[model samples]
Target: MMAPEDAALNGHETDKISVLIIDDDSQVCRFLSKIFTGMGYSVSHELTLTQGISHIFSGRVDILFLDVNLPDGNGLEAINTIRHHPSPPEIIVITADDNVDGAEIAMKSKAWDYIAKTGSSKNFRFALERAVEYRRQKKASLSRNDIRREGIVGESRGILKCLEKVAVAAHSDIPVLVTGETGTGKELFSRAIHACSPRCSEPFVVVDCAALPEHLVESTIFGHTRGAFTGADRDRTGLMKIADRGTLFLDEVGELPLEIQKKFLRAIQEKKFRPLGSKTEIHSNFRLICATHRDLEDLIKKEKFREDLFYRIVSLTLHLPPLKDRGEDVAGLALNHMKNQHGANLKNGCIMSRPFMEELQIYDWPGNVRELFNTLDRVCAEAGEGATLFPHHLPEHIRAFNIRHRYAVRQTETPDPETGSFEGPLVPSEPLPPFKDHMEKNKAEYLGHLVAVTQGDIKACCRISGLSRGHLYRLMQQYDIKNNADS
Candidate 1:
């Protein structure tokens, strides 16, 4: 390890900047470490990508020097994960292979720099210096503007990264493309962008590309003059026109008609369009924001979308991660939703039992945030005047989904009967139990736990299980299960 010197000598800030180098090559690690240490920055090295990623999440790393090929995995692929860190470090990809394609991939993944091992030491030093400077400026800029998160929730790394992007995008007029799974709140982010932008005081127009009538799509977008069409009994304003001096958010943009893409692209480029039956063009200056759950690239490949339009709208891209990947954000989102929607109904603020939260975290929310909110709504409704929520308050389907997932995991962990080993794939040594019998056993177990948790309050049991009083009694009788409150 090289001794740290005054960073001022290198025109760097006196405060130590942390740098992580993840390269299997010992020589490369040493060389990078010496350079960073000499510049008065603290340096750490890892031999594998996994260790590097773990180190990043565990502490503050201002910059990272990543190798494309490592002992465990390719560093290039882990860029997204690193970039989504709560305080992500600027990545400078250093690879032995001077592959042009690799450089393109690195830059596309938003790496700060991509340098080949064959490059001069001066090149590496220059890259490091620039990355540090850029990060300094970026931090200063971010510290100046706080993003306005209207209805957005969660402080997860993924959400924070997107919010940072939203803050940056709001200061510009460039077109933005927000992509995520359905129910991931694309429009909410768009609205946040608009709300934070200079055009916040102006109208924020929404054009649901998917829901627009096929016949009236063009008329609705570009507007229509009186008598222009059968429904054009009078003059009408288009969404684009209505969005003048503001934002035009095209939700589900992938659903936009292919035939209209060319015209739309032209209007976006020129900021001018002629409504139907109009002889002259009208210019409507509007900031464009588009969102889609579909993969625009795949659509382009399928010839269903225009390549030009895809490039035009995606000047800046923000990807919202699925809820399952957001980790503990699920609990925050649930509690927030409960407070906003059901706080008044309960005398005390609604609280979620630990088991209730665990069940929520385990289930993979396929529908993302929208689905999670809907599930919470149902739970609140079922919970009624209850101040606290339990796993039993969840709908039967969600509860069953979590149970099924746990069962699947357990099945995979089952050891081999003869080998007594869990190393290999699970192969049944005996005939599997009947599906009906297995389900009955699970049902009995669930009901027993529910009764214990609810303490046999029949009314509570009925409310939570969504079962009629008679049904609950019949199940209790069939299973020979007795609770103190049972009639």
Candidate 2:
């Protein structure tokens, strides 16, 4: 038996290993439950995808046996969210479909195993035992490896998953491709990887492909001889040479010129390049890391980017979620920013009001973390010597946007007096409800419709509603609404 503290450090909470079976088939659940029980493990089962997710969030679940098709939604779609769980379980995708595509998806999603539900009982048990053994070894490894996150904030599941991947990338020399929307901290992750890698002490060179002058792009990366070009007054070392035995981070690699892309691909593949006007080739050894906000696949389809270069850079991929999708991480990010920007103010007892934090959480930050920090800086300046921050401290545009969205939601929910239906225009004679009461009613109705439309898929609900998982769960509990519309 593992100590509680040790288990927690390994992302588990229970002394004994726990397993969860999330399949609607009663016979399947009973069968799996017995197998787990016989292995001296605790087991639980949920008949719907929604309940299964709820159970995972509410307690400790070390291993999950997930079904592809469920009563509420497709279980495969929930793998991303489950992988981000605070104490993520090792997922074993169990399905009767036996579709080749589904198996590919499950493996890509990082599921421990993908096996047909119709497989023999012995096969099933073998999978479980192997998965459990892997978990044990992984936990032991995790208990000893503490990641050093440089200036990265938020302990939300999304951020945690990213950090876990960062730790994995740090130990390898593999080329890494980090993708995310603008302002989502792609460069920060790249730097973190470099900082944790074996070459941490070496120089970490950066080449801003988007900022390089078109004519000088080649000489800038591969160096230039004294007489290479008109302006080549003296010998100049390129970024590639400077990054030798270190890390070479290509920021916004998508912006590389087509000709430059061809040269860069060869340089990376061979670790040797000929500087301009030089008859001999120079050798440089460096680890590669790239960051991009654009869809390289689409770029490849459009022929704007080379297909070979795309594959060459993405040996490992890490995606950073948008701030809006991070849920409660906003609070931690805000606090961390405040401490760095206004440490003295914090020491003086300045605090954020609940309404202020709620307003922050409700707004969809288009600029992500960078925008949030900028907004907070402005708010702190405006607060001056105030003891606490309030909703009024927020930028006017943010407040205005929330007001308009709320009103729009209300209008969408308003009904026609005569027809008593939402499809018709509201009657002028009807009185408007109190602001608080109207908002409360509309919130419930909106959530209900959201669940119905998304068919109880939590991922869809989050995307559609722009709510974080924790925030959505809290609202569901507050309103006493089930994740499924039928409930």
Candidate with top TM-score is 1
Residue range 427-448, candidate 2, lDDT tens digits: 4468877767765876788777
Model 2: lDDT equals: 0.84
Residues 352-408 of candidate 1 have per-residue lDDT tens digits of 889989999998899999999888776665566554777767776787788778767
Q: What residue pairs are clashing in model 2?
A: none
Q: After superposition, how far is residue 215 of candidate 2 from its true place, in Å?
A: 1.7
Which regions of candidate 1 fall more than 4 Å away from where they truly are? 1-145, 342-349, 411-432, 446-457, 460-466, 478-487
lDDT of model 2 at position 73: 95
What TM-score, over all chains together, does every model reach? 0.67, 0.59
